[model samples]
Target: MSRRPITEYAVLSDCRSAALVSSDGSVDWLCFPHFDSPAIFGRLLGDEAGYWSIRPDGETSRTRRYAGPTMVLETTYRTRNGMVTVTDGLIMGAGNRGHDLGAGAPGALVRRIHCTEGAVRVAVIFAPRPEYGLIEPVLREVPGGLLIRGGA
Candidate 1:
C-alpha cells in the first residue's frame, strides 16, 4: 500500500512531552500524563489513530510565528474569503520561567484560534491512538478529551 502524504507538521515539545501539529492545523501527535507515558494520541502514524485537530474549513493558505524568544508557535491560515490564526504554546511555570525543573510537570499543549479579515469555518477532529504501530488501539471519548488504550 502507498504511504500517506507527509503533510507539513510543526513539533512542540518541552523536552519531556511532544506533539505534532499538521499543516491543516490539527494536532496529530501527543503523549499525556508524561512524555514517556503511553501516547494519548498517535494519529500521525495512521489515519485511524491519534488525537484532535483544530483547523479552518475549506481551502486556505497558511503562515506561522512564535511568541518571541520562546518555543511558542502561531499558525495563520488565509482563505479566499477569510483568515484564521492559531496561537500554540506550552504553559510556563512560576515566575514566568520555562519548565526547567528537569522533567517535573506534565506538558500541556495550548491552541488558540481567532478569526480575522472575514468569517471562516473551523473544524475539530479528535482521533486517539494508543499504540505506536505494534497493536491496534481503542478510542474512547472522555469528559474533556479522548482515551487511547492498547499496543505492546
Candidate 2:
C-alpha cells in the first residue's frame, strides 16, 4: 500500500484515543484504552505494521460521512456492478452521551458492512501488530472469528 497523507484519513475516537482510517477503507492506525497506549494496529508508520480493511472486491469510487452527532463513520463504495457501505467506529460505552459520550468507553472498535444495492463482492483483511508493531501474533480461525495470539 502506498503511503497516504494524514489528511486522507478519517478520525474515529472514543473521546480518549482515536483511530485513523484511510479512504480506501483501511484502518491504518489505532491505540486502545488510552491515547498514549501502544498501538494495536500501526500501518500508518510502515506497510508491515498492521491494518484492517473492508472494501468492495473490484475498482470502485468511494465516499464517506459521519453519522450525525457521533464519531461513527460510513463509507460507501460504488462499483460497476453494485454498491456497498461499511461503517466504522470506536465504540463508546452504553449510555454514554453528550459531554459524557465515551466517558466509559469499553475500548472496542467496530466495523459493519452491508450491501444495500445489487450484488457487490466484498474484501476483508485483518492483520494486527500488537505493541507498536513489534509482535506478529499467530492467527487461527475460530467458531465466531479469528483468534490472534502472541507476545508474553
Q: Mind giving the per-residue lDDT tens digits that candidate 2 earns over 25-72?
A: 999998876789888788987877788988998799989999999889
Model 2 lDDT at residue 101: 63
Q: What's model 2's TM-score?
A: 0.85
Provide backbone clash counts, one per model. Answer: 5, 0
Best candidate according to lDDT: 2
Write down the TM-score for model 1. Answer: 0.72
Alpha-carbon lDDT of model 2: 0.85
**Total backbone clashes of model 2?**
0
True-structure RMSD, every candidate? 4.1, 2.8
